[model samples]
Target: MSTADTTQSAVVAKLSGLDRFLPVWIAAAMVVGLLAGRWVPGLEGALNAVAIDGISLPIALGLLVMMYPVLAKVRYDRLDTVTGDRKLLLSSLVLNWLFGPALMFALAWLLLPDLPEYRTGLIIVGLARCIAMVVIWNDLACGDREAAAVLVALNSVFQVIMFGALGWFYLSVLPGWLGLPQTDLAVSGWQITANVLVFLGIPLVAGYLTRRLGERAKGRDWYEARFLPKIGPVALYGLLFTIVILFALQGEQITSRPLDVVRIALPLLAYFAIMWAVSYAVGKAAGLNYARTTTLAFTAAGNNFELAIAVAIATFGAASGQALAGVVGPLIEVPVLVALVYVSLALRRRFTASTTEAS
Candidate 1:
């Protein structure tokens, strides 16, 4: 293997064990954030003022920290390899755009309609896909990094286009099914696009630039060994801290409507299960290898809750049901995806062994 591949492989190995525990840590952080929010109600407001222009500083910081490591790991040269994996790209797009949203709408309509707050919340959650977090998960799952990067880039672009369309359609066109009145979908298409660019695209560009600079200054080995690892924990901590502030801001609503957790969890769990099964089956049918299959599975299973929450708070008010639903998504998604990671590992061994035997 090349030097860069060897370095990446070592980093991936060290991360393999740690990856399984991240969901647990994230879950613990959520609980702590919720408790902190409940006890120290003013904390979120204090953090909220840390912003540039109108954007929340805490959130912007979180996005930067969360995205930096992910961006650093991305081999931009891999972008060239993306087109070679036509099956992975097509499967991800179809499942994410068509099947994923359809299932979420059906579940929300069936399960959450009577609860307008939760209904709107589910709608917001369902519309977004995991743009940032999936990269980490894909790496952990030993997925196709090139494919993951392309999907992340594509999903980021699609969220700008599809979020407003999906939001409006879910609210107005699907009102009969969801039993919710038509309300202005709050965020315009342009607004969603702008937020993605600011939150996702900008940070991604910064990350890439930083990685390139590090490579030039210290070489790739030094960059990966020293810089990337240091950034990982910082980013994770920033994400956790931001979650605490968000929960604190929404403390009263969350405390008052405790049952909303149950309301949101059902649809989220259902969505994860259905999407995983579909992605795996489709990948297998297309005759993809294990790594490609895992990439497809996670790409389908994860939602971009950060963007969703931002748009939700912007459009639906911070304490609106929709915003709450978006917050609740990661709480459900993290643990469920961790479980699916194990599932993917099991499937990988089985599939890889079969492939080896066949060959």
Candidate 2:
């Protein structure tokens, strides 16, 4: 390898350890957000004041900044290989769509039947897969960056297409299995498409363009060394502030319905545990390496809360129980995934030892 390749590898190695703590910081931000929401209700309106053309500027900016590096790293040419890993892809698809959702629905019903609003919220949270944050987790787990990029891209597309269908199925079809009333869950496809385009699509294009331009002017090594790291913290802090605002806006609901938060936690925790195990097992059975397995496991476990939250607000009002359920997803997800990263590292070492001994 060239000196630049060696340096970049070293940087990625150092970053692997630091990346594990990001979720902790994100969790801490959520707590701070809740406290801020409770203590200072006025900040919500102040945050709203800085809106841009009807969208929350801070939230939009946060998502854009957070997604830049993620999109930049995507190797579009490798997407073809996704079909080559048909077994892995099929396993993920079934787990994400069929098994994962069924388990979440059952758990939500078992845990929050009395609270229909929260039940709907949990369903919404479960139907969506991770779009933004999973990229970071995949990197930390030393996952297959190419497969991850392809999955991320594919999941984004699937989310837009399957969201309303899966959502309707959850609200209408699944509830009947549990003897719950069939309610029509309304979601505006156009509005959701718009939000996805603005928040996710635009940033993704911008990141791709920026990376391409930078490579032409300065070289890939220069871009990686000088530009990427500088923007890393901006994305982190942007997400932090957005969480603060979200909590601030929903502070009253959170405070009034404290028990409801606990109610949502059980199903979410169960969903993560079950899905993580299933993904890991499937990856191993498919003969994937540790890196790709970690990617698959995390991709299955994480929820795309940004889309869920936006849909919750659009479908059920900003302070609706559904929206709150979406918010609670990340609150639980961040910490659990962080712990799982450590678990993944342990598994990697064990697998390596076994392989070496066998060799």
Clashing pairs in 1: 50-57, 129-303, 129-304, 130-303, 130-304
Off by over 4 Å in 2: 1-13, 16-24, 50-55, 357-359
TM-score (C-alpha) between model 2 and the true structure: 0.86
Candidate 2 on 218-315: residue-level lDDT in tens? 98898888987776666556566766766666676777787888888888999998899889998888888787788899988988787777778777
Clash-forming residue pairs, model 2:
129-304
Q: Write the per-residue lDDT of candidate 1 for residues 1-359, one digit (tens) a residue.
A: 64434544454466633464676776777777778777874777787767654467776777667666777677777677776778778888899988888888789878886887777777777788777667666766778877777887888888877887887787778775555576557766666666667667876888789878889999999888888777766656656665665565566666777787788889889988899888999999999888788888898889877677777777778777788888778777877877787677656656755665687
What TM-score does prediction 1 earn? 0.86
Model 2 scores what on Cα lDDT? 0.76
lDDT for each candidate structure: 0.75, 0.76
